[model samples]
Target: MATAGLITWPVTLTIGAGHLLAHNKHMRLLRSFGEALEEA
Candidate 1:
């Protein structure tokens, strides 16, 4: 139904944003670790 789709669209976007934030955090950690390794 149209109503259902409207409800789900925001939920889907919220979930996508969460995933992107998590991925960015993970990548940042990995990058910092790589820098440490390079320094050592």
Candidate 2:
């Protein structure tokens, strides 16, 4: 199990990082959209 855990840990971290990056991108897009609406 130790070996399995060691292998899976990086995969888990990669998935978590991907999720965080996607969330940040989405938030930025929403912020830009809100700003455009305020300008209009």
Candidate 3:
């Protein structure tokens, strides 16, 4: 529904922002982990 979407859109953006912040904070570690998984 349009109403539901309006309510969730900002919530989704907030969560996405938080995820980006965390990802940046651990980017190097995450990259190495991904590489290890690929090699497995």
Candidate 4:
């Protein structure tokens, strides 16, 4: 129902945001590690 969806939208958004943040953090760490390896 619309009402249920409205209540859940914020929760869904939070979950999606967490996922994106996690993936971004992982990619950033990988890039940093690769750069460090190249330097060495």
Candidate 5:
């Protein structure tokens, strides 16, 4: 009972959203940094 309640839906959604947002922001920053390096 407790395992099923605590283990599934909410936790999966929370982790997925956090990872999605973080990876997107990281990619944007990496792209800008690459452009700057190329210009230099």
Candidate 6:
């Protein structure tokens, strides 16, 4: 069980990082799109 936890910890961190990055990218895109709409 300790070995399984050690292996999963890095996997969990990697997944969390990926989710955060994707969310940030999505928010950036939405902000840019809103700006474009305002300009138009």
TM-score of each: 0.82, 0.82, 0.50, 0.75, 0.72, 0.81
Candidate 2, 3: how far from true, in Å? 13
- lDDT by residue for model 2 over 1-40, one digit each (tens)? 3356755867788888999999999999999999999999
CA shift of 39, model 1, Å: 0.3
lDDT per model vs. reference: 0.87, 0.87, 0.83, 0.87, 0.88, 0.87
**Model 3 spans with C-alpha error above 4 angstroms:** 1-7, 28-40
Candidate 3 per-residue lDDT, tens place, 1-40, comes to 3356755767787888999998887998889999999999
The alpha-carbon deviation from the true structure for residue 22 of candidate 6, after best TM-score superposition, in angstroms, is 0.3
Choose 3 or 4, whichever is better by TM-score.
Answer: 4
Residue runs of model 4 more than 4 Å from their true location after superposition? 1-7
**Residue 18 in model 4: lDDT:** 100
Instruction: Please say which candidate is ahead in lDDT: 1 or 5.
Output: 5
**Global CA lDDT computed for model 4:** 0.87
Model 1 segments more than 4 A misplaced: 1-7
The most accurate candidate by lDDT is: 5
| Residue-by-residue lDDT tens digits, candidate 4, 1-40 | 3356655767777888999999999999999999999999
- Per-residue lDDT of candidate 1, residues 1-40 (tens digit): 3356755767788888999999999999999999999999
User: What are the clashing pairs of model 2?
Assistant: none
Candidate 2 residue 13 C-alpha distance from true site, Å: 0.1
What's the count of clashing pairs in each model shown?
A: 0, 0, 0, 0, 0, 0
Instruction: Point out the higher-scoring one by lDDT: 3 or 5.
Output: 5
**lDDT per residue (tens digit) for residues 1-40 in model 6:** 3356755767788888999999999999999999999999
**After superposition, candidate 2 runs with Cα above 4 Å error:** 1-7
Give the C-alpha lDDT of model 6: 0.87
